[model samples]
Target: MSVISEEHVRGGSVFKDISADDDDWQPTEIESLCMNCYKNGTTRLLLTKIPFFKEIILSSFSCANCGWTNTEIQSAGRIQEQGVCYTLKVKTKEDLNREVVKADSATTRIPELDFEIPAFTQKGSLSTIEGLLDRAVAGLEQDQVVRRATHPEVAVKIEEFIQKLRKLKEVENEFTLVIEDPSGNSFVENPVAPQKDEALTVAFFKRTVQQDIQLGIKADDDLDEEPAGNDLETMRNEVLTFNTNCPECNAPASTNMKLVQIPHFKEVIIMATNCDSCGHRTNEVKSGGATEALGTKITLHITDPSDMTRDLLKSETCAVIIPELEFELGMAALGGKFTTLEGLLKDIKDLTVSKNPFICGDSSTADRIQKLREFGEKIDKIIVGELDVHVILDDPAGNSYLQNVYAPEPDPEMTVEKYARSFQQNEELGLNDMKTENYEEKNNVPAVPGGTE
Candidate 1:
């Protein structure tokens, strides 16, 4: 029996070079029982280091007789000490080129698509922002819920959302990309951003007592410590609790309604219902504020990596445009999110990469592939600080915001303009153009004498 030392494993000397020929290879003495056939099988462990992240162990097992094969990836180092959330705006073609490292425990969501790629369902991957959205689109296409939708409208909506996601990759659409990891192992890289610029907002918050226990952290006397904040106080004071019938089992269920305030956005009324009898749970969000009237357009020039750090808040009613890139993102192309410029670029790149077939799949034309490659290279150059671009946000509802950290003192590279809405734009806002009085007039009905007594 051979003893495997912790140092040997951590130092990554347990595996042979993968590039060597099979005949020239000297197999490590590692052996394990085949998971499928219960026969002794050879195991190979490889160590690979990822830039800006940690080393990982890629282990493979093969049953020589039954031909069973399996591969697994495990982190070679300690678990992350804190959780992380990455919010990215997908506003331009360059934004789509950002690199993303998603751990197995990370959850990704594109609210506009009404799509969420939950943790544990996907293996850890190091891909571009565009690759991530492509995976989400693929998942939606194969989802049992979408495939077996009973209602035609539900199916149609799902298909429409998928199309929107497809459009998001083109330079013509915008969306918000968010990733949350409780383990703090995931990352969305902003390589072009300056070192001093906090391009990525790293918000640190204490994990729940339950989460700490699960992670094997020793608990102290402060386990019962209360969270202090206006938000908590509001939650405690405004929680409206009642009993309701569960939709799943028709059993009596408890419901709680509260007004929750999200930072950088208006308050939202959240209603949550849970049934203890049938294990049913549901939650809904509603707007808790009035809408704005005037339209707004925010323009910012991206010249240096530091510019990518600027915060952006794009409302659902906003349309994003990059005139130089000849791309425009219409309203509701993506849901609202608070993220940096670099994050947004990553999302667009990921979406565009995902829709390559639609973009240039007809003929095996070299010109088409070359053009796509050139376009991708241009985006890559922008991400690495070699190129500059302009980002514009046009919101008819005046709800979008582009953070100017150096306020009072204007940023020379940014411009904000407000304008009156046009006739069509005002109509879209559900304003005075609804034409309620024209129904009878259009149908050639004369005014009913004295109101149709």
Candidate 2:
């Protein structure tokens, strides 16, 4: 018989030390990307007003497992891409280091070797691999045109202006150019020709001129106009104003709940409600108005029982909530029905319960057993649906390594009898089966002293 303390009933117990016994599973340096290159691996960012690329990494991968796809957009619309307005390929160590020095770099960097981007572009239309790569490079180059054009009318109008960039890499891995003077003299300087073996097509274009001729093109006097126009200004301002936290207290209680908004589900809503120290409930609404934007907040009270139940069943972790009885139950191994905090305290009363009674690892099972043991003392023949056991790992010093094992959910594909036996063995053996299946004999972890449950 033992007792768990109230302070031990936190989720961090499961979250903090996520132990993967194998050393090979740990992250490696090759898996990490250079933050200075590729804008810390962020290829694109769509803000509340303007949508554009950042001039950092020429390209980076997004997760296909997370359903990220790249598609051409007809309009950036009201929502703008925040932070940097353009992205350039990391052409050299100097270019990479420049991005790293920018300070406010994006955090989406992936390990260079382990990264994969979403591949749903119309790449099939490309007749050759060169054409596909050229299209990607050209599209990226076009964004730079949209970034530095002088004329007010030239915003986002790439077809009229010729893009000229000095190919900075031998294999075209990434590119860079050093601006020689402030009067745009570097734009006129003729870059050294690529080596015969290089696969690079390095040329600078000015308006319609295709190659880097002498410092010949007349410098446009119209460079005096502001960088962004009224429409672009309004868009950038809106993008700058986007709140990534709660408006009232700046708390990060908001979550992106409405994940998808495809054709059939045109509008997705995300809401957050806070009852803060101010004593008033603040509700934030997003996508509930106008078109469904990427980072907006909304509030809606969920009333469906099945939705609540599904949320409860999402994990096997136990959540117990009985302020007075927390210490006793938390220390005891417990399980079943008590997947949530409020759900576990329904039966507690003023009854003189045993303070040191062993609670099973799973709280639901422990509560059920406690109730049954109390009632069966006066009745008979109570059929429990499942059982749980406390699998204690012990150090050589005789201290227990507290652990939990639970009966599995009923499976229709597996016969009830087979399921029962499997579930029973899991409760009895704890992690023995897992160790046998996943661990090799040559690399097995040393056993803890207490053995299986």
Clashes of each: 12, 48
Model 2 CA deviation exceeding 4 Å by range: 1-453
Per-residue lDDT over 154-258 for candidate 2, one digit per residue giving the tens place of the 0 to 100 score: 554433322222222232554322211111111110111110112221121112221111112335342335655446334323322223433333334433233
Q: On residues 1-453, what C-alpha lDDT tens digit does candidate 1 reach at each position?
A: 234456655643443334434443333447889978899997886554443344566667888989988765555544554566787777777777777778777788888766788767887776778888787787767764745556666767778888888888995866788888776767775533212113343332345665555445546543575856557566746787978777444457888888756565566566788888658766644445555657888999888888777766666567777676665655653445456777666655544443343233322257545655566666677777788788899988887777776776788889989899998777656676456666888879877767765
TM-score of 2: 0.16
Residue 50 lDDT, candidate 1, scale 0-100: 40
- Evaluated with TM-score, which candidate comes out highest? 1
- In candidate 1, which residue ranges exceed 4 Å CA deviation? 1-45, 59-73, 143-156, 195-200, 213-453
Assess candidate 1 and give its lDDT: 0.66
What's the TM-score of each model vs. the native?
0.39, 0.16
